[model samples]
Target: MDFKGLWTTIKKNAIHLFKKARKAIKRYIRKLVKHTKAGDYSVLIYTIFALVALILIIVMFANIFSLGGKKKSTLDITTTEVATPADVTEDPQIAAQMALKQQAMDIYSRNKDFIFLVDENHPLAEGYSFEHHTLNCGLDIDKRIYNDFSEMLNACNMAGYEYNIINAYIDKATQTELYNSAVAHYVDQGLLEEEAQAQVGKSVDKPGCSEHETGLAIDLTDVEVLGEEDYKSTRGTDQWLMNNCHKYGFINRYPANKVSVTGVSDEQWQFRYVGREAAEFMAANNLSLEEFMELVQ
Candidate 1:
């Protein structure tokens, strides 16, 4: 190994690197001095302009924030001032339902006491009346109710159970007369005028309040067995009616156990025509007409 030659080569390389490093450091110092020279006002002016630009950018951002805050405040003010009285009333959905109920009430009032006895020879029914007896009394049921009641009657006839319609719509005069008769009976039982009227359903309903007066109710009697009062007893054919009336869009209006709710006696014979869906829902839910009215209206 030529140790002396190797040492000489290393020494020469170290000197060369030292020169190169010194030159690079001098060049960097010169550049830094050139930028830092103080006689040039342009650099000072540029620095001042840059500082001003920064301040302007900050001011612009602040203005944007202030504008956004004002916009938000204006929106809140408008909302607070523009809300209307109608907007604060009861729900529109509820109002619409109440309007429908009012319409139904008007319709019922206009048709009060108009009897629609069952036409045994209706063209639509092919000469078969739903009623079993010759009296053939019934209300002019709503179209939907008529369809379901007709279907139910057809089914009952097919099953050999006899259904009869004893009465239907009664005008205001008839309702008043019936109510008066009841009041008289109660008065005979020793109740005072007001007390008797209240006890017998004569006071709460004037002629118009009775569903019967609306031409949307009917009184039915089952005649499967002889000497059996169908309306008074809930057995046999009467029981069938009680169980199945809801399916046919009819409900025992003054049903047993609902005297307090109805302000009337239980009339197993009396039925009111509601739509099938409504009848079934009311019966199943144990809802009285007033309760149903609350839900729907």
Candidate 2:
């Protein structure tokens, strides 16, 4: 109902009634003045009493109408249509996005325990197996995380942040080769074998101890800045990935500030998929995988 209009009409009628009553009271007072002049003071007294009663009645009616109108206004305000989840779900695009988010959350919940941290101390288990899916770029990753990884790269591309996957899914033999090569590089610098191995261990993971062995880590870099000495310091694809990868279930596995906790030097290009829930929590709380695992465990 149009309560405002009804209230306006009531107000107008009250004003009109007040105006009419005022004119009648004026006429009665004038008549009482003439009666008093003719010595009929009793008539004047009664007229004065009637005028007071009439004013009281008008004031009582005005108060009742005003209170009723105010209550109706309050009711209208309280019952105003506010958007609820159901209302928001009415939009098809929003509903679809919400469904996708829920689906991702469900997947994360189911695989919450799959966030295995592979580092020097926590090496990949013997005969560790995972289904692999090869991307068009000829890099293989864990099949379970392919969708999230692809979506993340796709989002990066959409945002015009181009990147190249430098490495992913290195088998134990490949990890061994890389580790030996790093050690050799140090040895060629005139260091003893033992000293070279120790130095290499500081930078490179030894075989099964590498996160790449899990098929859940990827190294990303911008083609434009690939060989730059301080590529990580530049604002490029890697930086963008580091800032936003968590939204797609990835985290900067070796953040520069957390080197002490991770026992690895900062590698801004490296990201590890730990599922959305864990990834987001780690990102938000600025936690390394080691710290996050400790908290959850």
The candidate that wins on TM-score is 2
Model 1 is weakest, by summed lDDT over 10 consecutive residues, at 115-124
- Runs of candidate 1 exceeding 4 Å displacement: 1-144, 184-196, 202-205, 224-230
- Per-residue CA lDDT of model 2 for 164-279, tens digit only, reads 88889999998899899999998999999999998876578898898898889998887676553656645668778888899999999877888888777756678999988777
Whole-structure CA lDDT of model 1: 0.62
Q: What is the Cα-based TM-score of model 2?
A: 0.61
Q: List, residue by residue over 20-77, the lDDT tens digit for candidate 1.
A: 9999978866655576694545655666698899999999999898887735576667
Root-mean-square deviation (CA) per prediction? 18.7, 14.1
The local lDDT score (0 to 100) that residue 93 gets in candidate 2 is 92
The per-model lDDT (C-alpha) reads 0.62, 0.82
